[model samples]
Target: MTPTLILAIAGGVLIAAGIYLLLERSLMRILAGVMLAGNGVNLLFLVASGPAGLAPIVGEDPELIADPLPQAMVLTAIVISLATAALLLAMSYRSFQLEGHDEVADDVEDAIVRRRAEADLSSEAYVDTSTDPNDDSDSESGGRFDGGRVR
Candidate 1:
């Protein structure tokens, strides 16, 4: 197979594995997944940038020089990934220090919200109580309105 095809396959595999790991409840696994996905994306960017050629300099012919946009994008992606990884690591560390484990637990608030949603119950805040008989806006707008406009 061509080198580009090989790189593409490798990138795909990395991305797939990353996604799989990302689904785990462990914070460290999530961090690893993010890093893997970032590297995979970088690899994909390299593959998309076409074969390497002359350095993109002022005197170099545009056609003969490699595209710099993809390289710049990859660099930006790497920085973003690094920042995300650092944030995740910090969070994991804090969790470990506080809870003695890196595994994420289901949030109580989330569970409550899910139960409410499953029961098809709207919160008190969403229940509109317009006592004005002349106020047809709520009926027209399905109980949603913003500054006399339907939202």
Candidate 2:
């Protein structure tokens, strides 16, 4: 098979893996899928350079060298992948802390619902201490709650 065909087959495999990962409910898997998809696209870029181009950098005229465009694209892709992976990992950690699990109960829809619930909880000021009516406690008196509108 031609080099282009080989690249295409490899790219297709990566894309398929990415799609499969994306379908998972676990946030970690989803993020991984995104990364895989990005990599597949990067591969496609490399393959689509007409199978014969320059080395993208300052170099001697090497016969049949790949294009600079693909190399540039790959570098950008790497940076973007790193950034996206970092952000996704951060989000996964935050989700785990909030929900006590990595698998989100409602992968997509629950986000809005959970957010609204949190918003409501914050807005409701569950307590009504209202402050010390008889300012008896000294200003230096420390407590679990440092004086404020309980509700």
Backbone clash tally (model 1): 0
Query: Which lDDT tens digits does candidate 1 get at residues 1-151?
Result: 9999999999999999999999999999999999998899899999998999998789878889988899999999988998999999999999999999999999986886777677676643344343575776557547665422233
Those runs of model 1 whose alpha carbons end farther than 4 Å from true positions after fitting are 113-151
Pairs that collide in candidate 1 are none
Q: Please estimate how well model 1 matches the true structure, expressed as its whole-model Cα lDDT.
A: 0.85
- Candidate 2 overall Cα lDDT vs. reference? 0.76
What local lDDT score does residue 69 receive in model 2, on the 0 to 100 scale? 66
lDDT tens digits, residues 1-151, model 2?
A: 9878998989989999999999998999999899988888998988886766655466766675665767788999899899999998998999999988778575564564566476665533244356675665623234343222232
Q: State the C-alpha lDDT per candidate.
A: 0.85, 0.76
- Residue pairs in steric clash, candidate 2? 56-68
